[model samples]
Target: MDARYARNIPALTEEEWGVLRQKRVLVVGCGGLGGHLIDQLTRIGIGAIRAVDGDVFEPSNLNRQLLSKVSLLGISKAKTAAEHIHLVNPDIEAQCVEAFMTKDNVQALLADCDAVLDGLDNPESRKLLAAACASSNIPYIYGAISGWVAQAAISMPGDHLMELLYPEETVLGDKSVLSFTPALCAALQTSLCVKLLVGRPVNTGTIYYFDLLNQEFEIIPFNNR
Candidate 1:
């Protein structure tokens, strides 16, 4: 074990750390949640990461996107995330795909990954990404934030959690997402991903909801309808 990860200690056994270091994860958005997810995954020693996002950093992103800054305004989010990952852990192989994810490209993008992380803001993209993950039989770590509320879930192969959570034609207009919202959701999503990487038994069908305003946490199980 490298002295860098020595502090991980008994919490992450040598075998578990080795597993994590060999896993490949794909993060499908490079904004708020995507930035934090990539940062945490790199530091935790994920062997390979592919970050995909066609959007560029804007002034509005500074409020919640960790990888966005005044200096990086108008820069590609995927490229920025890849650069940050290298700075955090050069040993990890980081790839940046600067393209909007569509049905034609999603399968190819997710083909080699063991798992996918959802950092998308809109329901349409989320649904499409989830479908891709489902078809590929890759685990998907879903996280979303609206204002002070954040929710996370793990959708294994064949799970319809995404469909249940994001019903079709129910478009939610851009809602205010505070800085802390993505931070909190991303942390939870990272923990779930790590657990999956280490072969831990995660609550796959349950959605963890956090209402920061009310300081309440709830776990709700979703039935496959």
Candidate 2:
């Protein structure tokens, strides 16, 4: 193991690190959650990462998006994320796809990935990605944030966990997201992703909720509807 990963010893065995070095993950959103997810994954030694996003950094993104900077204003989110990943860990292969994930392109984008991480803000887009991952038989790690609240879950193949968690009528639009919300949620998502990559037992089909306002965390079982 490299000295860079010295601190991760015991928590992550040598065998686990080897597994992470061969895993490929796709992060479908490069804003708040996406930035943090990519950052952690790169540091953890994920062999390959595909970052997908069509949006550009804006002034509003400065408050929460870790990859956003005044100098990077108007820069592509996916490109910025890939750049940051290379800066952090040049050994990891980072692929940037500057396109919005849609039903037509989801499968192709997620085709070769071992797992998909959902950092998308739109519930509809998340649903589409979840369906695509289910069809591809890949695990989808879902995370969302609004104000001081955030939720995360692992939607395994055929689980349809997002459909039950995010109903069809849910309006997917801008919400008051705090800076700490995505940071916390993204960290949790990365932890879950690492567990999956390391072949650790993860509690799939369970929604983990965090309420920062009250500093409370809860896990709710999710059964297919």
Candidate 3:
């Protein structure tokens, strides 16, 4: 047993740990949710990670972004993710792409990944990612945050959850998340990723919603055309 993952035992069977060490996942965005997602994914021992982000850290990101800090304000999120991943878990294969996922590069960026964890805030970008995952038969773990609220969902290929959830006119803005929102949401998203990778039964095509201040948790079910 690798002493590094000894703490994961009892919770994760030896077989499951071995399984996780052989799989790869792509984490899109490296800001609030992406920061936590990358941290959790690396600590959990996912064999390989491909982190994609184009934005550099700024003063506005300090409040909620885990990899953000005073001395690293001008550093790009991709560079920070690479640095953090190597420092946290050097054995795991890590690749950081210093660009946003766009229509032209989305497919290539997503290639060879077993699963994808969403940390992007824009609906259009999420739509692009969800579409690529659907086409490639990769499991997509959807995560988002707004103020005290966040939502997670699993969109298996052919589910078309993104299309059904976001209309063509969906505009991206007003994403007001607290300091803890991304951490909480990323935990849920990580759990879903583990469940899927470990062959556990998971609810697909459903949004797991959370309202922290109001203490409300709801399951919003939807269907594809």
**TM per model?**
0.97, 0.97, 0.97
- Give the per-residue lDDT of model 2 (tens digit) for 55-135: 999999999999999999999999999999999999999999999998778889986799999889887888899988988
Which stretches of candidate 1 lie above 4 Å from their native place? Answer: none
Where in model 2 is the C-alpha error above 4 Å?
172-174
What's the TM for model 3?
0.97
Model 3 has how many clashing residue pairs?
A: 1
lDDT of 3 at 104: 93
How would you order the candidates by lDDT, starting with the best? Answer: 3, 1, 2
Whole-model Cα lDDT per candidate? Answer: 0.91, 0.91, 0.92
Error of 1 at 186 (Å): 0.6
lDDT of 3 at 184: 94
Report the C-alpha lDDT of model 1 over 1-225, residue by residue, as the tens digit: 778788776888889999998899999999989999998898888889999999999999999999999999999999999999999889899999999999899999996798999989888888899888988899999999989999999988788788888777677765999999999999999999999989998999789999999999999998765
